[model samples]
Target: MIVAGFACLGPLVILGEYSASMLTNQWPPTLPLAVLAVIQAALLTLLHRPLTAIMETRPAQAIVFFLGSRLMSVYLWHVPAIVLLTGVQLLWWPMPDPGTGAWWLSRPIFVVAVLLVVWAISTVTKRWESPQPILSPRWPSDAVTVIAVALFVFQSLAISSYGLDLPLAVLGLVCTAIAVVLTGGSSNVRAPDVPSSTAEAMPPSPR
Candidate 1:
């Protein structure tokens, strides 16, 4: 039943993105918004329990453990990695039209190249994508992280709006790197001072 609901609403919301009337009517969020939320919640319900159990089991444990630290890296770099891929495409296929013979011939290679590039970048930068705990509870690290994320967001918006600008792209990348360094994402970095235990989920603590 939930799956059916999602299947029905998902298509309409996807198609509605092209509808100017829908945009105007729901400047912030329209029917599509509700539809998408319903779909997401439904899907999460279906997957959450099974995924949690699998992640905890013996077979999947090792893979899950490896991915745990790199989650942020994957999220943070995927967009810019894709943008970088566009530049890379130019080198191999000067004429990148979809219908062109060159494009057809090179499609598989391009896909593989993109996957490899994203993977390489994620591995190299994973350490720096997050801040580590400091000796004395360095407080300023939080603000630096926020600013770094802002820079990344700005770069993503700029790239999406007017295509890639190399200077801005580099600036965003540098900002994240600096943020990581400031947060102690290096050999000097230490894990956050908090105990490495999973406490039961609870409401915000007064302390």
Candidate 2:
């Protein structure tokens, strides 16, 4: 959104001097905002850990609760909600171009309307997508989980910000290499007990 705002501002402010054609064009001051948003999201997610532990420390339950929250459910239903709300809005106050004029570009009313529509749709979808029961222990080992999560975050960000270009492909390969190394190292570390029938049989000879 910050990037989009910059794109719009460029056209108006500098007489459309900034490059807006290419996908890799400068997004002006969006990097700071993006970084801040990422940091805030990480902090907020971490903040939930203590609260979640206080409520229930079970890993499965915690994972379900985290993913099954209203925020996530709402995102799943946002598209359908947008369709419905657009239909209703068109019927009532028909907008030819929602983002045409100066005020229209950043209309809080329109934003609120879309949010309301999403919330309503989310409420309905949440009924169907209720949190599933905690079955088996689904979490991977810590190292594996961390690598998987990092890869996922990077891939998701790349996909959203830029297409699957050379840079993203390189990033994906690097992540894969790191993950493989970590996993290999973890697997090389053996447990203390070495299983053997001879050792088990001769264990109580002196005792």
Candidate 3:
């Protein structure tokens, strides 16, 4: 299955690139992309066990945990980091024409700069991603959870549709705050226990 999945994935990727290049006013070639998605899902199903096994190693677990802890911060800040880096480059260096050799050559440096900036931002912002221990006796009710989720989804869609103006930004913030407050208090939740030997083997996560 894994071999078959790789065989399928190679051709699917090539087809996807071809389909992407042929794109016109249409944002995506829906039919081809949909077919690609279905094939990718099948490939995942075939490859999941092996992938899971590989990710279960100590080194993989460390890498996963490190990134997972700051996942949200990375996602939120990466675009801003890219924008900042582009601004810096524009100010300090000659702006290369798009698709030119100079532009292509500078991409690796831009990528590295963006990553570094995002990493620095994540170190501070990651605290927000961590869940604080909730001491409240009562957990969120199902109705409350549903309402919070609905508000979050609605606000997200509104922001996406209208773009992030002050009103939509405020609405998104309010929805996010409400969702956090609604979901905040749960008692008796604890981290999974690791064996002492495994715990000893694991490297300390940087603050």
Candidate 4:
């Protein structure tokens, strides 16, 4: 359904029915947006069983675990990697007609290049996305910090949107860097120490 939503997104944007600003400036959700949300929820609910079943299988579970490890890296780098490689491809090869066999065949090269770039980047930043919790103060704070960091990272990422906006891209890079620093520091923050006097001040428990 995510893919379906993305497929429909372009048309809606082209029709001037939606824009990122609507997400920010619009206070209450419009009927159309609400309906779309409901439809998306229903689609996910329908797919839940099949998705759960796939995860239950050992081989699929292993594949999932592997993918989850580098999911952040892949998501972050794929857009830029594809865009970079696509430009190079356009220069190197004659343009193929859209939806043609030649165009379809050419895609794997871009996909491979993206994957390679993602893997290379993972070596540097994968620790930030590690499942292993660093010595944060408490689980709650750590979780909130992680979520904030992830959200920032997501906003800082590129999806090969429209024309390249160098200023926005640079802003995103700076934001992502800030997230990385926050994440790293928060992960190591120790919980506040309880004094021995405070422990002793508590009423005695009944034996």
Candidate 5:
């Protein structure tokens, strides 16, 4: 299945590029794009078992858990890290022209710099990502949870629509805080136990 997934990659890349070109030319090749997405998903389905097996190993489990713990921080801070790095670079030195050999060569260094910045940011912000102790015993009702989610989605859309200016940022923060508070508290429910096995230590798949 993994071999089949790899084999599909060549055709997938070709079709993807062709679809991209069509979109770039202001011609929406919807069918081709949809086919590409389906094929990509199928490839992932094919590769899933083998990838899961690989990730079940101890070393892989360790790496996965370490990153998984701070996954949200990594996602949220990476773009800001890139922007910060680019600004610092602009202050210190002129940027190489895009598509130049120098520009290509600098990509690895830039990526490493971004990762470092993200790591630093994650150290401070990871506490937020970690599961916090419930402050109240009252669990929120389903209706309240839905409303909190709706408010969060609305605020997120508002931020995206009106750019992340100071007011919107504050509004987003307020909305997110409210959502968290609304959803916060303890319940009698408990998570299911994993069976004792080498694979049990690994985090559950994101799928």
Candidate 6:
């Protein structure tokens, strides 16, 4: 659906071929799509086994909240953070902008930063919901902090160096190593167990 939506607006993005037009026009078949999405969501909500299974996964809730919180966080403070960081960088390093030819650098930095931010949000949320109560107060675990900081620094370097920063890539790999060490393995964040009644309604595998 998303791809189809984008495809409907592909001509606008390709540029030079189409005249400037209002961005709102890009929302092709908006009413129908919106109606379909709502209907799908409503139908899914009404389904028994699938909906129950969905609610049973801790990771699903964690992901939904993680993304929601991160988006809200960005909405709350991104402008201020950007302005403050830009000021600091300008005053301290005074780096020149990477020209159009090397503009590909911007995308990786953006990608890394958004990924790190989302990871941070997910980690913190998992920590908050940890089965161990005492550890909850120590929210946003050291592992999350270390990884987020390392990724941010690597992204900043990549942004400054126009995709030619070998050290940044190495640092990213090192962060991955540290994450393994800290978590011992991947965090198995699952939603709390579903009721037995919900489970009973699910179709059984064929014997």
TM-score of 3: 0.61
> What value of lDDT does candidate 1 attain over all alpha carbons?
0.66
Clashes of each: 0, 0, 0, 0, 0, 3
lDDT of 3: 0.76
Angstrom error of the Cα, residue 100, model 2: value is 4.3
Model 5 agreement with the true structure over 18-90: per-residue lDDT tens digits: 5334323223434445555666787788889998999989999999999999899999989889889999999
Q: Better model by TM-score, 4 or 6?
A: 4
Candidate maximizing TM-score: 5
lDDT of 6 at 161: 44
Cα deviation at 112, candidate 5, in Å, is: 0.7
Minimum summed lDDT over a 10-residue window in model 1 is located at 18-27
Question: Which pairs of residues have clashing backbones in candidate 5?
Answer: none
Candidate 6: count the clashes.
3
* Winner of 2 and 6 under lDDT: 2
Model 1, residue 44: C-alpha shift (Å): 1.7
Worst 10-residue lDDT window for candidate 2 reads: 20-29
Worst 10 residues of 3 by lDDT: 19-28
Per-residue lDDT of candidate 3, residues 87-119 (tens digit): 888899788998799999989988888899999
The digit string of per-residue lDDT tens for model 6 on 29-94 reads: 244345446556656666867867886899888877756655655554454455555575568764
List candidate 2 stretches off by more than 4 Å. Answer: 1-69, 83-109, 127-136, 142-147, 163-207
Number of clashes found in candidate 5 = 0
Candidate 3, 50: how far from true, in Å? 2.9
lDDT of 2 by residue, 31-73 (tens): 4344445566766676787866666757767776755666776
Clashes of 1: 0
Model 4, range 1-207, lDDT digits (tens) per residue? 666765665665566445454442133554446546766887889899999988899999899887888888888777777778778878997869866998898778767777887788887878878867545344335665776677585653442332236776676767667776665545555455779999799889779
Off by over 4 Å in 3: 1-36, 137-147, 161-171, 178-207
Evaluated against the true structure, the overall lDDT of model 5 is 0.76
